[model samples]
Target: MPRIRKNPTGVDPQLLVKDAAKLMPAPTRRLFLRGGASLGALAFLTGCDIVDSASAEHVLMKISYFNDRAQAWLFNPNKLAPTYPDSAVRRPFPFNAYYPEEDAPEVDKEDYKLEVGGMVDNKKSWTLDELYALPQETQITRLICVEGWSAIGKWTGTPLREFLRRVGADTRAKYVWFRCAEGYSTSIDMPTALHPQTQMTFKFDGEILPRKYGFPMKVRMPTKLGFKNPKHVMEMAVTDKYLGGYWEDQGYNWFSGI
Candidate 1:
């Protein structure tokens, strides 16, 4: 069976191109078009959309034509499509080739429970049962990515703030550090870290957070870049120093926001 699709989000390329073109002079626009065509054809050949971002801008514009006709072009939505009541959000087609590999969160999920440690009076590991026993919260929120796509979905889980409060975040605690199953990790500030909309999601669209979609848990923040939403979270640490994120180290903005 095919892996079920999950978490679709992206930006409207044509609109992005249009916006980009409007910024450049007419002569520059022509150059960008030819370059875009060459890049687009290469992407088609290589099965890569970002083979050349500078050149593919025009091609993305052309793709946007069909996407627009499909009424699926995304950026900021004037209105979101009716939530499926349908369950199972389809994963967006990824055009970039930076696929990161990690151990699946499902195989030994309980084997690596979330450890709450650092600058805390009570350092502990939380089991699924323990997290479930906390007062649960459900919310429908939009996932906006730095690449420009957006999607809305339902999430149910314990609020990060609530979890920290329950575990007793110390006065010195200024950041929440998240360590994932892949040995990958990231951190967030206190405010965004504890945002009302942020959650250690248990369910997506009324179902478990599937393996491909970060089974055990992932961070969901309304105010930051999607990359900040790390997956397969297994550890939460309250700290003071700036624990820069994976993407941030790669020249991407740490404060990736709208």
Candidate 2:
């Protein structure tokens, strides 16, 4: 038989609550603590026992949902993530993904086609040349990762909202999901997908995006954590259904706001 921990720790409940609150974002944590709810009370509210892994996961899931709702309520679509000066742009912006940099998928520039579908009037696939011809803009923004590091980079791309508009997307949809060439996928709430800063990046640092940094294309979302920004995207769909992301399904929060 496996031993089960009766208490999360030997620490007092109040102290545990205080320490656990650090896991939450600053704003959400403040709001959560405003009612001065006890740790036991909170656990009960989640309908989970703290006795085992399954019950503990249930509690954590509830907390994640609470955090998600809090962030959704606080999010302002019009508010943009901070932009940095060109001089502050990090040279050789770090390459990050579930796979090693050398293992990044090699997209054939001549054969790549972005398949767009779901809740859109135009479901036509687009080539890199076609996408490049769309109105382009540039922004220097910081990419905040869940791993506790960030880098500023200049990304050149078509505003995602504009592309969606041209495609006659249902802007009122609940979510937008992307599937990448490298077997990674993620989703964003509609508000974040349509945010002015959301971009379909094709270039980095005044050149074609290198393979290590997502060769054919990437969906860059400054408002979201790094993992939310999928790279080497091959397909996209706008939907009202809950399409969980790779990380989200594995316990990361679905609405992973920065």
Root-mean-square deviation of each candidate, in angstroms?
13.0, 11.3
Model 2 spans > 4 angstroms off: 1-51
**Residue 163 shift from truth in candidate 1, angstroms:** 0.4
Q: What TM-score quantifies how close candidate 2 is to the native fold?
A: 0.81
In the range 70-125, model 2's lDDT, one tens digit per residue, is 99888899999999899999997887765445556788888889999899999999
Model 2 pairs in collision: none
Q: What is the TM-score of each candidate against the true structure?
A: 0.61, 0.81
Ten contiguous residues with the weakest lDDT in model 2: 1-10
Report how far residue 211 has shifted in candidate 2, in Å. 0.7
